[model samples]
Target: MVKTNAMRMLDKAKIEYTTREYEVDEQNLSGSHAADMMGADHGCVFKTLVLKGEKMGYLVCCIPVDGELDLKKVAKAAGDKKVEMIPMKDLQKITGYIRGGCSPIGMKKQFPTFIEESARSYSEIVVSGGLRGQQIALQPQSLIGFVKGRFASLMQD
Candidate 1:
């Protein structure tokens, strides 16, 4: 298996993680599709999103494939009065990752990250491996610590 930047970062941090590779369907790079390919539950698969807050420059959010991020809650958790997703065209330049392949780990810069509190219920969760068709699985708490992130109510009720 080809190692991705995310995997290499984990290795360097001595962070235990497992990788799963699946065939790429560029037309359907949704998180749910990835979970289906890995034969895992949708809730255990997370997507990383980058947003810019009015008060903060940049922040990250990791939510379940099946969950939706409530922007108001995200803003509250981020201590910003408001927040909005960065334009897709600016994704790579800002985070060094493109949509469908962005990982909460190994971002170009360590933006303040927040993981859905629901993830704490699971032992391990899957995230993009910093590349399309590759995924990384690791403990939820481990991810939070590695990313120096906090657990918050980031999803809609």
Candidate 2:
């Protein structure tokens, strides 16, 4: 398996993680689909989202595949008046990752990151491995520390 920047970073940090691979479906690169392909629980699989905050510039939000990101909560957590998802066209240029492959770890620059509070209930959570068809499973607290992320209520009703 190819080592992505995320994996390498975790290695350098002495963090333990396991990688899972699945076939990428270009037409449907949803996190739930990836979880299903890997036979993993969707609630424990997260998708990285890049958002632009009015004051903070770029921020990364990681939430469970089965949940929606609550923009208002995100903004409050980010200490920004407003936040909006970055355009797909700007994702690569901004984070050095494509649509379905964006990982909270190993971005072009370390933007402020926030993970859903629900993740704290899990011993380990799955996140993109910096590429499609790949995922990295690791302790949630370890990941939060590695990315300098805080737990926030980011899920929508």
Candidate 3:
């Protein structure tokens, strides 16, 4: 398995994680599809999202593939009036990772990060590994601490 910047960052931090790689399907690059490819539970697989806030500029959000991000809740957590997803074209420039490969760890710069509160229910969750066809599974708390993230009601009911 190829080591991505995210995996390296975790290694440097002495964070324990397991990497899983799957076949990439450009036409169907959804987290749920990735979860299916890895034979992982969809609820345990997270998709990292980058958003631009009215006041904060940029922020990172991680939520389960099966859930939807509550923009209002994210704005509240970010202390902004509103938040919108960054354009796909600007994703790499802003986060140094492309669409199907963005990770909460090892971005060009660490922006404020929020993980869905439900993540606390899982001992370990899967996140992108800074590259397509790769993922990292680690304790949610460890990931939250490493990224200096807070648990928020990020997902929609």
- How many clashes (backbone N, Cα, C below 3 Å) per candidate? 0, 0, 0
Backbone clash pairs in model 1 (N, Cα, C under 3 Å; residues 3+ apart or in different chains), count: 0
Question: Please, what are the lDDT tens digits per residue for candidate 3 over residues 1-157?
Answer: 9989999999999999999999999998999999999999998999999999999999999999988999999999999999999989999999999999999999999999999988899999999999999999999999999999999999889
Q: Which ten residues in a row have the lowest lDDT in candidate 3?
A: 115-124
The regions of model 3 sitting more than 4 angstroms off are none
Model 1 C-alpha lDDT per residue in residues 1-157, reported as the tens digit of each score: 8899889989999999999988889899899998898899898899999999999989999999988889999999999999999999999999999889999999889999999998999999999999998899999999999999999999998
The deviation in Å at residue 90 for candidate 2 is 0.3
Q: Write the per-residue lDDT of candidate 2 for residues 1-157, one digit (tens) a residue.
A: 9899999999999999999999999999999999999999888999999999999999999999989999999999999999999989999999999999999999999999999999999999999999999899999999999999999999897
Error of 1 at 107 (Å): 1.1
lDDT, candidate 1, at 80: 91
Error of 2 at 82 (Å): 0.4
Judged by lDDT against the true structure, how good is candidate 3? Answer: 0.95
